[model samples]
Target: MGVFSTTSRYSLAFLVMMNLCLKAMASESDIDFSFKNFGKVEPHLALYGDAEVNNHSSSIQISGSTNFSAGRLIFRKPINLVGANPRTMVSFSTYFAFSISGENGDGLAFVVLPVEFPLNIFDGGSMGLLRDRKIKFLAVELDTYMDKTYNDVNNNHVGLDIETPVSVKVGNLSSVNLVLNNGEKLQCWIDYEASGKRIEVRVSKFGETKPVDPLLFYYPLDLSQMWGDEKNGVFVGFVSSNGNSSQKISIHSWSFKSRMPPPRWMHSEPLDPDNVVEIKGEEGIRSIPKRSDCTSRVVLALVFGAGCGVIVAFFIVFVWIVVGSKRPVAPEELAGKGNEFEYKKFGEERAIKDGDGNGEK
Candidate 1:
């Protein structure tokens, strides 16, 4: 029964260790995908209203050349905004190539909205969103038509919107000698860093190198608060609408990638005791080591393995000394040949003597 209990305990420990390993692996849920040309049809895509695949151009027509047309092209799966730990927010970078070929229109936007966002709330000037007070979303708008209701900067500009159509920050493309509705393909990049709580946007003509400086940079925007405890996560998509029949918004290609970084301590190294400095009473100060001093996971693993090996070796030596000290000693009379007993006292050496007297050797 005791042996069975010991085996069961070992099995339980193994199972628990395996469960922890699986959870660690599962926490690394990253999303990475790229769409080149979008093919002749939408793959793993969801379209609503006037959104469709343009087989001739091998692109996604976000809004058709029709008056008051609104549409959305969303990836089917939701991207996690909050990490598995719920405290860390996921950081992401997305790039898309699009073109607007028309005389006049409202514009389109790349949006992140709740998973249960209503699909029917799309309008031309609203950029496929409604003016409801309850809806919450984040968007990067490429406006080609100025609307007074939303206080648009101009007909050719980029804006970052939080919750409402009204932008908190706007960037005029004319300053950079770029036109939004010039019927030319353009590329846009949006990056968010969870560590800095910052988001940046960049735009350039298609096939051009990415800009060194971002067109717009917003900080202190905690995206984790945007979802309001919506466990299902957020949906990422392109929203577009046209106010005139001649307006057309087409997306040539798109790609998205996201990462959920581990806790800061996981990337840190054990501090050296000798390097620790005693803090004085607000007088002298010294700079600590940089974060680059932290070792990688490989080095940490090797160190941990070495520590465990030392502990196991010490335990083996300890057991050997304990058992050896407790061994029974043979009687002096029974210490002859074939006595089947041989023991040495600790801290003493045994000397054998010859059979004759005074022949000690």
Candidate 2:
């Protein structure tokens, strides 16, 4: 029994430690980042449609009077999906080269979605490029119109995005940096139109350009692999949609190419397990969540110790009363009534109590 108890104690301790490790890992997986934007122009996009990359210039200007719930303008180019995921982490910062001809209700959106190679147009800003894998590169939208579909509080708010299950807001404005690097990071900022007077924004691929600020991302990439298909390349372009209230936005230029990012990590499938949650810092920085660790251990020790102490105290009191108190002089009816009570005695305490009562002064 002693040996068994010893093994059980250690086993329980190990299990608790393992549970802590698992919880830490699960929390780590939940850390993510996203972005924000301002409505400078209506939402628009470029559908690589039948446009010949060799024949046409890479950019196009969309012109229209804005007074509709929404509309789409697409400028498409054919490109590649380099890494493991045809999808790449996309970040966009939008600017209005010129202002809205009318401003009561006007907004703009930037998008990267797949379109049928010829040309694909659905209800502008409605399908939001529905189910069109070719035209839908995960998109960033600046919207001014509110529909029941978006559940917007009003047309003034901005949002971060997700397509399949639902679309939700992330940040609000005219100028914002929107980033999506998988689920772990989705960050954004929307520039207030009031502040638009003195604003400048830039977008580049940390692709070919060396970024002063580096971004680490994972893509369906093949560094040294061979590729045979030309259409398989990535396509990126600008898009806009206008509401019944018209707005025009001009994009000066945009660029894309690959650049070396900071060292990053990926756990291979069926990965070897020790601690799956990642924590990075200065080389010598403490590697744990200090306050959390301290509080958790303190709380756990108090809980376990308090619980065990209460139980042990109760057991001791029970045993002491059994051994230290007159054992009820064995109630006459229960005395020796069962095998376990076979040696029980009758009531001496009752007789003593009756005598004492009669003699009370």
Candidate 3:
């Protein structure tokens, strides 16, 4: 809706934006632009209509026009959100945050695609307009119906299908934080409870007088909006459509960081000039490192491990002492019978008798 704040500072480490809500970001710096650092690129289609959300709430009215025609919203032209170079993309993705009530079709997708028209729509009839299309876009869908082919979290669930696969309404959402990636090949990160306000961290940057398209292109985009490297690009706006079926979806408020998570590397360390480790990939493809945001994680893990070891050792020592005490004491030599050692084995005898059940009287 409005520009994010400028006061906050974001390191190259990670893009830490404010939590999304109905409210706009305080300034431009707080809202992350995925490709801003690499180059100047603007989203061919970006909307903050009814809402703009993330892993949590994702539902909306898919239009400034014709969005309410049916129970579903559709897209005639695909919206592009580019991150890095398309050709070299090991994986590409885009996110659409919206919500759905009455399930006639599926919900939405975070797609990285190849074409423009003939966009995808729903198969199971929950997310209609934004459902199925036979194009080159990768459909990371949060499906809500049980299509015959493909996997499902339950009757209704979240799934990742390449360019409109068979009907796959995997799961439904009350408040879900779903994610799609290429590691397990495809996976959805859904959460039980919406994350409470952890910390009010922030970051931002200023805009330039120069055109912003080149920078926007650095981030990934959906196939529908992938037109090539052109100067003074065409119409740029969030696109949606509603077929015979109409559903409502919206983006609550989008707050992105310049240092957002990498495409396939969420848990890896940022590129550190001080210390860097480059791992080889399959073939000639280079692989990156794991995310090193373990500032608090490492400390917590060590503390817990040590605590458990201490508790275990204390228990073992306590048990050993108790068992040793209960063991019978050996009798010392009794010197009383004219320099002769008389056997005084009462404790030993009692222990043996008890062991043999001879002292049962």
Candidate 4:
């Protein structure tokens, strides 16, 4: 009995240790955030500058200023840019919904920086990012206004910035012709593939599906080298700024996955049109339906209707033929001398009369 009890205790201890190790490894592999409401957010989220939680709408307003304001929201927990095994790097993807209103001056960016917690940065056109030679970071900027100093391609564009405000590459937002400060909400997707060291950014109107082509694509970025020898991880968050003309920048929803094409095990809510905010003066800018999908639907409807009509016509014709065959022959036509039935009856009566006459004789 003593031997059995000792073996059971050892087995239970081994199982507990294995469970703990598995959990730790899983947490390192992925990080997911769903900002449905502030109450549900993890305690690690640190809000800095003008950022605040709006309980009425359940969104985080990063910056709302007419003069000059800045805001930053950073996750306190550091994420490994490269996995535990140095040879394999960790890939990441993110989806977010945001809106800019009023006179849009500057813009907002999603950033991964090697800075410590409680970051206080510059405002205005800088987008609240710290500009220091020693600071290393990567940013995907959604710029709204043109800056001559940066050689901006257009007022509305997306850019990839590495270690400096000047973009290494930029893609013009040709689809958006209207002023972005019109209170229109937009959604964006960012994907980073570690193996290829490539990054892609896609944008679409809020509540619409993602576009097939990416607006910005940058390749050959060495994430491991970007982290530098001193750092093996970085903090992820958002930063926004406004200049003389300001706007209200808010994040309605956000999600992050630590793997490319996000695994099925991760749970995130799909975009819902009913939850999207209706913007005025946006009717003209609504997305048009795809030609192929519209054509297919119309063709299917016509084929189905034609098939039903043919079946109904055949049923009507069959019913008419059946009714005509059952109709009785008219009595006037049957009594005519040329009728076969009338002739047979007359012969039978004559034969019976002849028999009667012979008996009388």
Winning model by TM-score: 1
> What RMSD, rounded to one decimal, does every model reach?
11.3, 23.2, 23.4, 22.6
Which should have the higher TM-score, number 1 or number 2?
A: 1
What TM-score does candidate 1 get on C-alpha atoms? 0.68
Q: Which ten residues in a row have the lowest lDDT in candidate 3?
A: 192-201
Could you give the candidate ranking by TM-score, starting with the highest? Answer: 1, 4, 2, 3
Write one digit per residue (lDDT tens) for candidate 2, span 230-317: 3344344444444444444333333333221211121122222242334667764334435555575588778878887997896567
lDDT of 4 by residue, 297-344 (tens): 588778877987997886567555545445456578556656677789
**TM-scores of all candidate predictions against the true structure:** 0.68, 0.36, 0.31, 0.62
Return the clash pairs for model 1, or none. none
If candidate 1 were superposed on the true structure by all CA atoms, what would the RMSD be?
11.3
CA deviation > 4 Å runs, candidate 4: 1-27, 39-42, 121-125, 176-179, 228-232, 260-361
The superposed Cα distance between candidate 1 and the true structure at residue 194, in angstroms, equals: 1.4
Residues 1-361 of candidate 1: C-alpha lDDT, one tens digit per residue: 5445555565577669869997676456578889988777756789888888888889989886477888899998888887666677888999999999755687889999898888755543478787555778999999998888889878998999999888999988998889999899999999988756788999999999999999998876788788647689889989988876568999999999988755454443244455555555567875454444434545777887898799789656755554555545777865674533334432133333324435743
In the range 104-176, model 3's lDDT, one tens digit per residue, is 3344444334444333333323232344444443344444444455445543344444345552222333223
**Is 2 or 4 the stronger prediction by TM-score?**
4
Model 1: lDDT to the true structure: 0.80
What C-alpha lDDT do the candidate models reach, one value each?
A: 0.80, 0.37, 0.33, 0.74
Q: C-alpha displacement of 50 in model 4, angstroms?
A: 0.7
Model 3, which residues run further than 4 Å from truth?
1-60, 63-87, 90-97, 119-134, 149-155, 167-247, 255-361
